[model samples]
Target: MLLKKSLNIVMFLFILHFIIPTTTGYTHSTLEKTHPVDREKVTESPSTIELWFEDPVVLHADSITLLANNGSKIELNQTNVDAGDKTHIITSIPEELPSGKYKVNINVIALDGFVIQEKIGFEVIKEKATQKKEEKLKIVKYSPDDGEIVTGSPQKLNLWFNQPAEITAIGLFDNLQQPIFLSEPMVNTEDPNHIIVEIGEELSKGTYQVTWYAHPVGADINEPDILDVFYFAVDEFTPIQQLNKGEPTNPFWFKSAGLKQLGYWVVFIGISLLFGGTFLVSIIARQSDSKKWFRITSILLLVVIIGEAIILILQKQELENLSLRQFLSVKFVWIPILQIVLITFGLIYSKIRLFFFGVTLLLIPFITGHASYPRYGGYLTILVSALHLFAASIWIGGLFGLITLPKKEEMKEWLNDVIPKYSRWALISTTVLIATGIFMTYSYIPSFSTGSFVKSEWGKAILIKSVLTLMVIILGYLQRKTIKRLTSKAFSTIIRRSRVEMIYGLLILLFASLLVVSTPSAAEQGVYPISKQDQDRELNVNFSPLYPGLNVLTMEFGTKDIEKVEVTLSMPPNYNVTYNAFKVKDNVFKITGNLLHAAGTMAMQVKVIETNGEAEVFDYRIVIPGEMRLNE
Candidate 1:
């Protein structure tokens, strides 16, 4: 039955995948290609600027501007959508441009509300323009001209222009190309045309880029805007004095996706056995003395659930680059705490009370999960999730209760009678589970059936999970059939099939848990910020690509006011420690050394101090990538 059903499922998915609409119309809405191409160097100036998008674009605010090497704009008289093609945005250049490096900047808002920005560089060589001595209103000179390297940190940046200009905003980007948190640009009041931006913080040795937009101070509102971009490098600055590839101090938790995944598996089983088992035994009476299952199993299961909750939270916090204090403030942390208490009571005192409490326990996942969002049907999704969770738990837990029951003459009579009844319960539970699963898929997955199942990781997982679930149902049905025969040989078959069914059930829970971490296909494309919950004054920290390499660290502090912050990172092979983080802006900081040199449960500590003497301390675990790579 299992093989037959699995094949049927495979066929269904085959049809689903092939007959589905390609994502070509939805996800591929970014740059197809750009005019002059990225990093192109040209000898001739193009008469018009153009941009091509992969999909139909709904235009919002759009800008296509040309800029000189210095911070000054060259007028492109008019810009509009190409009459012949909507995909291309065209801008008309006024006259032949002078010989100088120029940058083209384009910013377009897609119909889906996603902002796409692109910049390309090219040089024109036919004619040379007069120097600053001439009366052209434009930038004459600037430092860090196109990929120039700096020997040491520069004191300040200087911009000279033919016309006096007022600064608007200036931005600095790091190696990862994220803008450094910065204050607004400061212009020279004494020299209206010249702007002097102070380098408040000394930059670590690395390649960086600066981009800015400004306009002639008193020009008409319709005049073209000045946009400029340039690269600068801090020559050979290594924050760490030395390297020790010989040994790593931290353990696997420093970057442990494996640890988190393991936590998910354990939590699922614990929930199944504790709540599901409790619910099972509450109504199913013992006959000929209950199968001699150990009473200590409840205690062990309780420990597993509580411990997994802790491990899961820590893993989530680390992956998000957030400190524990910040995580504690999130509404999510409370669910686990309440679960620990209720599950503790349920396990210690096995009664019908536990069955009711188990139902309440389902709410924890509901609140913490993505379904709680209003867009996914909010409370409606929560109710459906509750039904889905409770039913599956009872079904799986009942099977576990049977499997663990001692195979003596004692349970023979009781097991035989209960098997048929439990089978009926399992049927109902599986129905609810599958139905809710479909609803959730539709809620989060756009054009779910119309699009290829492989289009998104979420889709692939859902597809695989559905197939596995169908196979589990097949096994469950076969086990139910065996129970009806009730012969000695048929009983043996029941055990075998139930064990297989249980395994698949656990696997289904795994798939569901993983889907929580995934961004649904319908949730718009590209990396969406991990939705965080904040219920109090909490300090939240996050780091990206939590790997053995350099990564960006960000922090959001609760109760903001006038203050300074300090952050540090320590890496050890064995007591060899070093601090490698520098302040970027306000609460944000970046790591500059071999931060995660170990593959064990490495912990990084963060400290926040206010202008006064008050301070808050937080520590987070980040396992180096060995078993699993997180922080992606």
Candidate 2:
């Protein structure tokens, strides 16, 4: 009883060691903010307001609005965030923002769900109208080159504005007057005035107009300038056609490709062993007396070498359309060929030297070139992968070979000898397999901790692979242990356990497929800004259908700019609404319309977008649980 208890403790410790090592240093969110600032104080009527952040913040021009002291909101239609400096500079601050104490309110959101609301109050002093408008105010250029051919499939449309115009007010329009959807235009930080717009995907052939409006910093809240428009065209051209017609059909043999490749390797290896075994039996049969096993083995080796050469030729042809010479050049092919040549000489001429020469030739390519780079984890990976392949070939290919061969005492003796040799190699191979697998997981996947593994797709996949690998290791151990206790009855047990090990190995291979498909962890994708503050002053809300649910929905008033924002849904009693709050980006909160479960058009109300615990109210109504959709 004591022994059994000790064994259980040992097993538990082993399991704990395996599980604990794989669960370290994981994080759920990859986003991180780089810069911190108390606030911004503006002194002059600067053309743009620049705020710096430690990491990149997603800037949506339509979502940004500047509020003046007179209770008026200035719309910043197009704002571009500088990619290089981690700064957001509003282009074209409203020219009419009259001298007054003004607050810059910004609602910024990052791609990874971080929201930021930044409020920087600056004083805009009144300037005398008598002072001639400074020539430093560069002219806004809005003309494309004359005679430039507009192609229907042009990759992008270029807009050159004179002087650096604050880019926050530029918008592109399609032929139908609808806004053309485009990702934020990238500006040359070195030349802050130059901006390039990249068209998304393919554009239809037609004329497109890009308009610019000016939103100067500290400008009067009521006044905004409408800048000139630029036009470009995509001329008619030959339509690109698909090379292949019809809906895509899956390859008929796709499912069988892996099985077919495996079968080919098995058959090729089996033939070599078959001829070798036959030759051995023939020599043994000829022996009238003495333990003539050695002579039979020697003959079998020669026959096997010849069979291997034939198999090599067939394998080469099956791989691709290659010249016989080129196929022979491949190291895997050449190794067998050299082995055959040397072994043939050894058998006919009684020259053991040739066998050694062949072995040397086989080791050449395995040691050089890209295969030996230490930074790539070097010789270790090669050794592990080779061992894995070899063990697989022996266990899978050898079994098939044994079942197909004719029964003979010499053949049986050879099989028994090879199995014992293979079992020892299998143990080493399994060790290498586990070690290399762990190295790869830690190297490629980030933080294997419980949090990361649960939150990230890549980590989850690696966790699954690790679990499967452990199962394979356990099965392999059982097989090895069963071999030590071998008896007449143990043969069936060993075979069954070996089969289980093979199945586990296959599962590991399947996990490999999934690992390749998953995205890299957050650390690899680089850091972005994330906000933790609950109240953000720069909350902005836009609802569709103008009115929602029966409740008097009021968009309460609050600061125009904030780092993060949250909205609370409030409704009169007897009405039920279910809502989901999503941080769309760094400073964007998308409070979805509530779904009313009750039968009546329930009156639902939401206070104004809240920033930093402050709120503004905007009231609207809709039929409860109506089919109306709201897009922000």
Candidate 3:
């Protein structure tokens, strides 16, 4: 009883040690960096104030507001992220921003869902008429001789401005009747006025527009400013030939798949031989051999199954689409079930049947998953999953078998019998694992090159996993050879080798965990595709309820054209309604009203009528909980 309690405690500690939380601190590396935009002095009557960071930041445009010394709030026309680097650029100025001290209050949320608040103050000085007259207009020049057709897509579109223009906007679009939006453009630091728009992928032969617009420093427009546009064409273009094929962009993560496959096979085959041999040896010994060997094999198999189950569960969670149902539906599941059934029948009846049944059952999952896929034109997924399960069972289960076997001569005969039988199975399993791994690498990542593998995150991860797998294989070889000796002196050495292999197995597990979290390649985050969505219309409105009401409401909308809009706020039966409409912009409107004695869920109706007499109505409900914060 004491020994059992002690063993339980050790198992509990192992579980606790493996389950640490993975949250870490966020550092302000990009935000704190000094850039050219930051070094510019606070100019009197500056056209635009730009903030730059080292990395791209997720900004909440709605939350950002600029407050002046006066009561008036500055209106922002546009907020855009610079594609070249980590820069947030806001364009447009207040209609009549008077010369005074102004504060820019920026509340931004990053990509990782962390909120950051920043406030900066700058002085706006009154400019003399002479200073405005002295300001010179900047001219820009485009490379490729403006009309030259290159053989292949140019890496960059170079633009040279006569003078440094405060580049308000710049982007490229494919020349389709409808505009094909390009990825966000990044600014080139090599040349300030000269910007390089990077074309990361191959471009088809077509005419393209290289549009650029910039506002001169210290320029304020009473009317709308004119934007500059340029056109370029790519004809007879050829794509770059890929040098490194079948290499993962991030080697570390990519190689992990292979390493895991190798490790699983080694462990699976090792365990199978050990137990099968032991059972055979036990039966051949005197009937009074006590059948202690069979009990040991059962316990070892259980331990291995449990350990493998934990690893598989963790993996299933990490790989987005992987599921237990999917895994169980495959051939691997059948193999184990068969093995268990065969072992049960053998234990109850004949030892020879037990050996044959166990061997056949063990081979099913591996062969079905690995061999029957392409060559046999069977269910590929089932085959792969079966292979995975077989490898894990053998490797992990085999170690348990080695550790628990008794040192008696009867046990030696069992070991000798099990070891040779397993060797044949192990060799077959290892070969199948390697072949499948190679096939997967080629099929999944055609663009994988040697350079990409070394340089990219995925490649590096795959390399790490591969190295670990090799170590596991080496340890496996040693364990297999040592167990075959079956002498008293050899027992201790074999036990130690098995322990070392187990350590390597655990390390492989850790690498698998890391591989799952990282981006699959330099260009992509594992399986997640990167894309951008454009907003057609945006509206923001804030309203305070006049009555002792449960909820306060706000509504806002903005579009390209102006149209008539109607808003209604429903009040309680006893309360009177007063509505006022205020024009924020030509197309923007705000309605403010109060609801007296409003309770529960309040319904609000909004209607908009365009010039064509088409009306759109929207209904909204605001729920007020029992508790109310009067201060808010």
Candidate 4:
């Protein structure tokens, strides 16, 4: 019993000590990616300028500006959010721009109510007067539109152009770059500018791409043909699946998270021992000596109070990117710090009042957690969370007190009485836990759809925690059955099962930690659009599932035996994350993670180091999708 209890306490403190410096921090909305890209050069003027962000941005009249090289503001159409992809804010150029360097400046409010300002610059190359005049020859419309996900295969491919154009060549391809048969292009009967081609065979359930070459009907033969490409999916399988190839994103939370969960676990266990032991002693086992256990519980509470202070300080420092001294100066930071100090004094000076007043301090986590900022039932959720915490502490702490009881012959009589009384309390606590758990789940999740529960990180965490809780309940049931027998053998069995139950309890706390950090599905409205692709003659880069969570990035270098590859990804002003890509096969390198912070736009820089120590750098700007409306 001594060894088992000591090990549990050591494990609790060990996790608390390590995670004190890295609890979940503040979440500020940020830019994800942008169109035109920063410092890009294009051969022709773009029809529209677009921006993507990790969170929704509030748009206004002066939200966007197009400034020429000499600081002249170019007129633009009224900016609006993209209906299909809420995270995208777009505005038209109205008229074609002349060849020059231009800057797009934007100022918008992020979801977290912070004003974000950013500038994207690109150069437009001058085209010949004749070529500019012939720009009307471009394709105006197409079937299975670019990046569209369709239900089934269509019979023929169609294209519409603003000007009469002769199709030179047409090709179709699947995700694997395998060619699909296409009939020779023929002109539509009603419109000379429209071209049509029959599909040689029915398409399968996968993403498909169409490439066509065309030129103006009455143009010079020496002029180059116009090349165009578009993609559509037969079903839901998108290009993101191609890049990831069914591999799960790197589990960052499992790798380096759960600090807060462990911190709370320690606090929960500490309070449970202090108060649960009191309940057991005063009500169930008044004649049994428990001073030694009470002493351990008092010392553990002191440690927990100190740990809470350290976690608060570290969390504030990381959230604002501030130094310890700078964080200390923040007035609001002191409120929690002072609260903790008073809780410590209460623990030391007055045990009776401490049981009531100091215990209330533990409820602070419930107040600051999801309850405080729920999407619905705000105050009701907070109250439910408090009840949930109170019940859980009693159940877990009471179990601990039972398992650590002295097992001498004289103590057997006391054990028999104590076990039955504690069992009743455990049953009541467990019932409250289940009811509150269901209420909180309904309070947080907007929808109960299978997709809503299975798709989001927040949903997954809740599911895992629920499963663990069920397991603990099963163990409790067995222990309850064994208590009715009340033999020495049954007592040993109950004690052993109780230890396993506590371990499960700890795991439940860990998933609870994950839930605290994960954004609820209702909150993350970012949509998965087409994969962002950038390539040159020598290198190709693909970033997929361009939302905030679980992303896969692939890089292919043409025929190079690369020694190493490193990528630095950033969203200007605030967010930056770097990862080293591992060679998946040959010259193809891959890195996957919850890399993109939010839905918007992101800039990525890749450095490829050759075997001879020579390095080549590549840059790309990509967009991610999020909720359309301004976040509350």
Best by TM-score: 4
lDDT of 3: 0.45
Candidates 3 and 4 compared: the better one by TM-score is 4
In angstroms, the error of model 4 at 286 is 6.5
TM-score winner between candidates 1 and 4:
4
Instruction: Work out the TM-score per prediction.
Output: 0.44, 0.30, 0.35, 0.52
* Model 2 poorest ten-residue lDDT run: 623-632
Per-residue lDDT of 33-135 in model 4, one digit per residue for the tens?
6678778778889999988765456665567899999999999999899998777899999999889999998866443222356687999986653365435
Query: Tens digit of lDDT per residue, candidate 2, span 131-239?
Result: 5554333334433321122644655545544555455566665555557666676666777656666667676765455666643434456855635444454562121
Candidate 3 lDDT by residue in tens digits, 1-632: 43344457545534544453332112211243221122233334555556654334444434346677774678776656666654554545546556677776655433322234455666655655235545445455666433344556777767666655565666665534224444454456766666555665676675455556666545675524436544445663121122333632322222223322332333343345444434334432224333665665455455445534443443333332425564454333434455555555554554464465346444543432222322222356445544543454455444444545445764665456655454445455556655655554343233333543455434455577678777767766776677666776776676666556555555554443333323232311111111221122244434343223322334456553536555565433222232223334556554321232332324455566666778765555432221121111
What clash count goes with each model?
Answer: 25, 62, 37, 13
- Evaluated against the true structure, the overall lDDT of model 2 is 0.41
What value does the lDDT take at residue 606 in candidate 2?
A: 40
Candidate 3: RMSD to truth: 23.1
Error of 3 at 335 (Å): 16
